[model samples]
Target: MTDASLAARAVALDLVREVLRKSVPLDDAFDAHPDLGALEPRDRGFVRLLVSTVLRRLGQIDALIEGSLAKPGLPKAVVHDVLRLGTAQLVFLGTPAHAAVDTSVELAAARGAAPYKGLINAVLRRLSREGAELAKAQDAGRLNAPDWLWLAWRQAYGTARARGIVEAHLTEAPLDVTVKENPAAWAAPLEATPLPTGTLRRPAGGAITELPGFAEGAWWVQDLAASLPAKLMGDVRGKRVYDLCAAPGGKTAQLCAMGADVVAVDRSARRLERVKENLARLHLTAELLAADVATWDAGAPADAILLDAPCTATGAIRRHPDVQRLKQPDDVAKLARAQGRLLAHAVDLLKPGGTLVYCTCSIQPEEGEAQIDRLITRDDRVERVPVTPDELDGLAELINERGEVRSLPGMLADRGGIDGFFVARLRRLP
Candidate 1:
């Protein structure tokens, strides 16, 4: 194998180990791994695919490994990661068996698992032969996702839909982007399909930076469901909009694109820098503040407020597969409390006649519907604005009975599913 290929594999292996054993999110690992960016573009792509594929199907890969091994337990080291990636290639990636086995053995030895090199070789070879049939015997989502999350989904979505959610998580997400203006005009030029919601959808894979209009910043990567909350604001031309917890700035960009003077607030200075970079690229401007959204005073009441509060991010597992393993039930409960606080605080930031759009990129009702319900119940000023069918491009199914939007990964499956999101539009009392 080429040196670049070997280096990429080693980095991918480290990322898998970091997520599985150390509980680090894959996105954070990618940001932290210096070698990943230094590699050739092709190798870098391979590393990402290898790491994500392994994470997406880790449960089935481990089950296949356990079946192959004569022993019961797998070590949390180089040997284990090597075997996992090897299995991923053999079964999921459709790599030639010999290539998978040889590279894995090489990687195992290089990673200081020299003692387990023979073990890695034997295990991978066996998996290459029998892994597919064995994988069929496993419940990939049930095995891969943490039990706490699995139960939460079952309780929240019911059995059939919960199963569908897990099944969707196994597949990688499509590339969906929001544009500054004229989605159709840019869609054909960019080789993208414009969705009913005005977001452009493209097949997943390829470096987003390499895509046309990226450097020019005509469009930015934002999930179809994620872009909806800003649309719920109706017309915000010249309106003051406060986007709480707006890091990475997808919705903030949307609000800015719609001619809103947006104030984006978040606690992390580092993440807010990303917002600045995106705005600069898109030639859109927003007021950015590095302060706690729950406590930071906006200096003036907003005409509209978009509170995209933090949650467990279970709905985004298709894109961030590592979330399935890293997020715990306690994480959900803790975030729900924060969501409640943020929702309450956001209400205070809105003018009496303004819109308060509460949304999360999470599917959890506790973070979405339940939080809003509580806010409207206790506060006389808050009431559901009820998203009309016309606002969502006639996709009335996405709007819940309570007039909230709950999008799952399973939605729009034929055209490649969108990310799961929950959005509720509320109005402040006059």
Candidate 2:
């Protein structure tokens, strides 16, 4: 194998280990790995694709590896990761067979799994030949998601629809961006399509940094589902808007674009810097606060508040495939408790007759519908504002009988799907 190719494989193996073994998020791992950024841009993209492919199709790849194994128990996690890497390339990515096998064996040797190098090479070679047929025979949906998540989805969405969610997650998500100005004008120049909700959907191309409007700050990378909460605020013109727990501030930028006197608050100073950078790029302004929203004083109540509370982020699994691997049931419970705290604090920061837009990139009702139910039932001052069908560009199916917006991955399957999100627009009584 070429030295350069081996280096690329090494980077991919490191990322896979960081995510699966160390429980680090893919994006965080990417950011922390100096080798990843130091590599040529093309190689960086390749490594990213390799790592993401392994994560997204891990279930199927593991099944293939297990089928090739003679013993019953699983290999060591590192060895298993190497096997997953090779199988991902062979079965899913259609990588050249020789390159896949050689690189994986090299990875095994370099990563202290040298004793199992033969096993890695043999299994991957067998997989390259027979993996497709094996994958076809297995349940793709069940194999692609973790057991707890699969059961949760089945109970919540039923059998067929839950399967569809898993299926959608296995596919790569397209790049959806929210533009600062006219969507139609940008769509034509960028070779993108305008979604019903006015977000621009572009074909997957090179690095997003190199995209046309990116440097100019004309738009920001945001999932179509994630952008909906701010849009639900409707005409924030001159309104005092607080974006709680805002980081990597896509929603905060949306609020600023609408001429809101926005105060964006979050606990991480580093992440808040990203918000400031994005706002500057777009020629927008917001009052940035690096403090916890649950305890941060807004001083005076705001006209509208967007609590994009942090949660398990299950709905975003399509985009962040590692979520299923890293986030546990306990993590969900912990996040739910935090969301409850943030929701209450958000209510305290709103004016009477003002709106509090509560949203989470989580399909779990505990973080979405159930949270709202708990809030309204316990606090009589809170009541559902009920999002109208027209506000969502006729996607009324997203709004439940109680009038909250629950967007699932399967909702826009034909258009490359969207993140799972639950948005509730609540109003405080006068």
lDDT of all predictions, in order shown? 0.88, 0.89
Model 2, residue 115: displacement in angstroms?
Answer: 2.6
Instruction: Give the per-residue lDDT of model 2 (tens digit) for 110-195.
Output: 98889999888889889889988888898877898999988888998899878888988988789999999887889987788899
In candidate 2 the C-alpha lDDT for residue 318 amounts to 85
Task: For candidate 1, list the clashing residue pairs, or say none.
Answer: none
User: What is every candidate's alpha-carbon RMSD to the true fold?
Assistant: 1.3, 1.2
Write down the worst ten-residue block by lDDT for model 2. Answer: 72-81
Q: Model 1, range 288-349, lDDT digits (tens) per residue?
A: 99999899887899999998898888889999988887887788789999999999999899
**TM-score of model 2 vs. true structure:** 0.98
Give the least accurate 10-residue stretch of model 1, judged by summed lDDT.
72-81
Runs in model 1 with CA error above 4 Å? none
Per-model tally of clashing residue pairs: 0, 0
Candidate 2 Cα outliers beyond 4 Å, as residue runs: none
